[model samples]
Target: MTIGLMLNALGAGVGATTVDATARDTPSASSFGIGAAIWVLISNLIGLAVGAYVAARLSGTSDNTDGTLHGLAVWGTTFLISAVLLGNLVAGIASTAATSASSVLGGVVRGAGSAASAASNVAGPGGLQSATQGMVDRVQRALSGGGSPASMTSDQRNAEMATLATRWVTDGRMTASDRERLNALVAAEYNIPVQEAQQRVQQAEQQAAEAVRRAEETARQAADTAASGAATAGFAIFGIMLLGALAAVFGARRGTRDVLLVRGTGNVR
Candidate 1:
């Protein structure tokens, strides 16, 4: 039984690796296709069959039914040991894969949180509203040809605009007062007309919406791929195990017949 388990593990590992490598090298080849499944089944069947034959021969059973029963005992013992080992291996692999996926997902979530934080910060004390009011007062002075608010540095103006944009994204839609204030700021900063500033704001909003949609789609695809891979692996494991039992029974019958033939020939001699 132990020998059987070892042989099966080695055969399965090699076959799976070979199939995976071939699929990687072939353009458009699927890793979890029928070929891979067939290889796994064949490898397991061959290993179990060899084990069962050895067990029957060692038992010295002349009756086919007796040999078959011995083979079944061998199969059951091997199956139990294999199941325990496979379960441990699977648990370890699942833990590692889950950790990796969680790390990646967490990174994405953190980035999204950062974006949200930036937007929320705009509503805090001494935030976007205050910044926008300061910029507006300066713009009004500049438009009146005062040349005093022009003393405000370019860095200050840029920071104020960035804060307003972050707030706009989080809010999803601008209030009437925010729209008017933003329009005035843009017109003053770029020397553009108010109508052009409004158009620019609308374009920015559309781009933000598209970005959100893309993020959602990417997350969904990752989840689907993980689910499909898990399902395929589970089904393949079950099928290989079932086929292995059938092979063990067949091998025992063959071994028993061979023993009976040898004994009869000896009597004739």
Candidate 2:
């Protein structure tokens, strides 16, 4: 495990040096990522192989099955150790996050308490009344739709918009009369010709529909890409693990072969 970690560190150092020494005018981020992953895999395989070989040798096992079992045990041990290390790292991060969240919650609670303490001041003269007046003015300005409606007050426009919105939400479409009514409302509000207002409304509807279609297409494509990426990652993880196991088995077999060589030289059974 130590040997494997050392190899990993050495590879990391070499990779860092290589990146720093690169003179490429247009370096691709993905290429660097792939290189790092490959290096890490190689380092891990080498470490597992060496560890398994040593374990088998120390067990003094000449049997292939025994050697293989030793290698598997080494692999399992190393995997467990790595998992524990990763778990600890995750736990530390969670702790730090929890700490920060608590701090934020505490600040929010303090602010709420301060607000409660100043409730009398908030209820004092010209406070709530001014805020309410400001909100009403803002609403009037919004309902005015960039200016005062040419033939209607802000309240009338607001009521008309609310009714139109309700109709659309409830029935999802406007009838011919509804279309005419909307066109007249727009024409009256902006003092434009009814024909021009109708054209504008049609254009707005088409643009809105197109925007929705494009959004749906983009979302579907994003989902497909995410699924493809996840599948690839899953398969790659399985393949790398399988290769590491094979490396361990091969190393153990070599260790057993070495044992036979020693036995034959010593003239022992």
Candidate 3:
């Protein structure tokens, strides 16, 4: 199985490189295709067959059944070993990808935290008697409602916005109540007319919708690629295993016949 895996990997690499070079100028250039899959299947089948044949020949069995069993054992042992190694490799890759994604998300969170800290510290040593306080006083005068988000500290405002954005993403749209609150906050903070605030909200909504559409499309393409790869792998595995079994049986039969012929010839002599 080890030999088979090595040959399959080498053949796949060469085949993919060759295909890529040949299709370099083509619009539909792709390294993966039916040809590549077939090549991998054939390489593995040949390797496993060769291994099985060698085992049968070395077993020195006159019985075809015994030789066949030995060949089957070889194929089974190699397959198990390969499966364990491949499984570990795949697990390692998945773990690394997950860790990288988490790290990126954590960095974004940390950046947001730093920005909020900077906003809060704009008051400097003057405490509440700073420029930030002046802005707060103006916001209080602008907002008629006591629940204006403009009165929130920068960190609180950031947290609220994050929560709203999360809700929009999860629900696929902003609720009317959330939109109204957001519009009120925007109008109070920017000292804009209600109509202009509504327009701004509408534009933000459109942009968010576009972003969601793009994310969905990207996810769909990734899923399609994964599905195609999985289907191809499944077919290759089935074909290779079947071919390996047949090759081993044939090799065993030939080995047994040769051994019996040699023994009979010796008896006659």
Candidate 4:
């Protein structure tokens, strides 16, 4: 049982490494392989000795039957020991990693959403609103000593918006209908035409700003998930090996005793 438990742990570790590496498309997925192997070897050796000693003591007769029983005892105890000690450890670590990953994923999604929303604020029913908003945001972004959104001069804000609207119209981001709508809204708000409205707002600013935010958010989320998965897998493997050792130890003792009894009765019969 002890040997079996050790083998089981080793096999499980290998399987986990293979699966993780394949899934992640990374070559270093099994970086902890050496550590896991070493733990198994050392712990199993100890379990084997303990199991053999216990089995010998339990067997009343020193015969071939008893010898066989001892072997079984050693195996069983090894498994039991490994399982109890390692299982809990692995579970705790894996849980922590999973939690971390979840947190990272949530943060990334929230960041992305916020960026999209910020860009959307500049867009209006007509291209005019979006153009105007883009200009205001850019000027505000560029201010020295960073005062407030209200700090930009009205003329500077107007010039920026007009530049943005023209760019939006030319870039195919806005259509004729969009321009017309923008003009109507501008005329209603400031008695200006669609052309004049275009001069008031900018287009490239909106797409550029949103794009940058989206990229950053995506990268952060990916990194968080990767780190979490690595931690979880390492802890889970450690726990499994420890538990397996425990199972092997206790199990070996019982098996050995049963075998000895069977042999003794057989010899008498």
Give the per-residue Cα lDDT of candidate 3 at 84.
96
- Going through the candidates in order, what is the number of backbone clashes in each? 0, 0, 0, 54
- The top-ranked prediction according to lDDT is 2
Residue-level lDDT tens digits of model 3 in 32-144: 56666677667766776777778888887777788889878877877788789899999999999999999999999999999878866774667646776788876654433
Rate residue 182 of model 3 by lDDT.
Answer: 71
TM-score of 4: 0.31
Q: Candidate 1 lDDT, tens digit per residue, 40-134? A: 56666776788788888888878899989877877788779878989999999999999999999999999999987888686776686787799
Please give, for residues 1-269, the per-residue lDDT of candidate 4 as tens digits: 45547765776666566554446753354555765566666555555555565665566545545655665555555556657878989999999999999999999999999987777766545676768789888766543321222444444445544654677746847666545544444444565665765565334446656876898899999999999999998886677655544554444444443322435745842
In model 1, the runs with Cα more than 4 Å from the true position are 1-40, 57-152, 168-176, 253-269
lDDT of 1 at 133: 95
Q: Ten-residue segment with the worst summed lDDT in candidate 2?
A: 141-150
Once fitted onto the true fold, the runs of candidate 3 whose alpha carbons sit more than 4 angstroms away are 1-47, 88-177, 258-269
For candidate 2, the TM-score is 0.74
- Rank candidates by lDDT, best first: 2, 3, 1, 4
Using all chains and alpha carbons, the TM-scores for the candidates as numbered come to 0.52, 0.74, 0.55, 0.31
Candidate 4 residue-wise lDDT at 63: 55
The C-alpha lDDT values of all candidates are: 0.73, 0.80, 0.74, 0.60
